[model samples]
Target: MSTSTAEGRLLRYVDALQEAFAQEMARDESVFLFGLDVDDHKSIQGSTRGLLQEFGPERVFTTPLSEDAMTGMAIGAAMAGMRPIHVHIRMDFLLLCMNQLVNIAAKAHSMYGGSVKVPLVVRSMVGKSWGQGAQHSQALHSLFMHIPGLKIVAPSNAHDAKGCMIAAIRDDNPVLVMEHRLLYGTEAYVPEAPFEVRPGRARVVGPGDDITVVAISNMVPECLRARDLVAEVGISAEVIDPVWLQPLDIDSLLASARRTRRLLVADNAWLPCGASAEIIAAVLERAGPDAGIMVRRIGFAPVTCPPSPPLEAAFYPNPGTVASAIHAMVRPAAPAWQPDPERTRLSYQSSFCGPF
Candidate 1:
């Protein structure tokens, strides 16, 4: 679980995280880790594996069930010159600590007139699988993006995950690192040393001129699938992954939208004043009244998430659905579904387990 590697090891999403934690704790004597089940046998789904034995109880331990009290303790520790990394098994549980996170941790530096800093890292899992239902599965990046002074980092690959985790630990403010549950099994080439993926930047994953398909978190992989499906129909789409949500890189998005003359935002949340809406508004503001850019938003259906598999399929958008949307946008009269649904639908990896 050492962060130092031979430069090009293929690491899964969970492995990248463990390496980042090991490297940071070893580098900074003042850095410590804490959270629910962080040091237990489960090890927070293996992201904190081997850390307890390596760092010992003082540096790595679990907390009580009280999120608000535990969050306050982390904030106090940060103010006292110690970097604290707090882990949440699910982002849904973060709702219990909103007052401390949004009001105190997010506003400390500004309130103290830059006299103090809160170098706090809050890592939470975000995604859906195996009928976990609504309580355990929610991607609340859009919700946190609306609040100021909070840096939200949702890395889509192993490289970005390791880099962003390291960056968040060293940052002088409260940063939220959101990890998708299904992405844990995804493997990619990552460097062995710790690095930083700066916040407020967007990465252009695929290049095209017909449309700009903006995605975040788990939607990134789905967008890649949609790109291939759309390519078969002679549609070229440029995909953009906004790793940092709060201080969004509007410049890159506007550039893509201007060139493509069409934009589609795919977010993993409901679509009422969500991330998709925010992006569309920003693009329109810069493009002006006469701009012919046609904008559309794709997200979860406006209803409570159902438990049935068939209903869930219709609720969540997949590559097939995304490709169909692009087809309809490019040619309004085109059919929504292809000749066969079985061949078009993409499935998740077998390694994905039900919410624990």
Candidate 2:
């Protein structure tokens, strides 16, 4: 669909994903969907809800629980000119397929001297919910970003979610698209037809001057909440969502940093040597050290996520935590603004009910 026509509709994040799959599958004969319960009633948190009905069991089918073998099969299909969209219920499960992903799928094109293309899309979910605990709640984009031949994208909103998924499906290389579990229900204006958000771009969600807040995946919404809270205290925060992590738009990030002179990275992963650390280093290197810029990072606490509800709440950084961190970094002596505890608790849509 054209850009003008796409703006005429509104959609939930999960609906946008379903539309992307339906549109692409309708448009191309090579595209196929497979993973655990992709065609079931639950439909992988409803992202793949209606795919099987539209495309039939041959094109959209569920797979066995063998991540390694299934991933290898998808890689083989992609190598032979089939476009495969592999879905994982949890990003943590991606660890089981690292050998196929990092070694084979990621290295195929380069290892073969560009003689073949992988045209593979791996869709995985990463976010915290219902005390999912340490094993299931990891947002490990940093690990995939370290590899050379893979493209990694984490969309925060519905519009980008649809656009990026289309781009990944069409791209002739291996792409890992990470979706935040909490963002599946968030609604936004999306184009009715297919579109591409384009990889390697940084979108400034909230434009401000005092500081530039770079957020990733689910953290983008929390940062927006923080922006509103900080505004009451006269701190204007510019929020930048790095939609594509692999080919990161450093130019846009540096531009925001130069104008604000302060940057805070809010990522959903851990702190040490994480995406936050990499962004800080890149910004400082390009923006220059003499600029006297201040940089801080907020992410998962430097420990395993706790299973208890209250401890899990403390473990993950919420809007309140983000706002408090900004308040402290921007002004040391000012009275801290306290957000309502009830408001900080993250809520899921009624449709979202399980790990599947």
Model 1 global lDDT (CA atoms, 0 to 1) = 0.86
Error of 2 at 283 (Å): 1.0
Residue 340 error, candidate 1, Å = 4.2
Candidate 2 stretches greater than 4 Å from native: 1-6, 333-337, 342-356
All predictions: root-mean-square deviation over Cα? 3.2, 2.6
| TM-score of every candidate relative to the true structure | 0.95, 0.94
CA lDDT of each prediction against the hidden true structure: 0.86, 0.88
Predicted candidate 2 versus true structure: per-residue lDDT over 1-356, tens digit per residue: 11212364778898999999999999999999999989888898788878888899999998989999999999999999999999998899999999999999999999999998899999999857676888889998999888999999999989988999999999998999999888988888998878898888888888899889999999998889889888887989989998989888988889888888888999999988888999999999987768777999999989998878779878888888998888887886888777776665445533456544
Question: Model 1: how far is 220 from its true place, Å?
Answer: 0.4
Itemize residue pairs with steric clashes in candidate 2: 6-191, 6-192
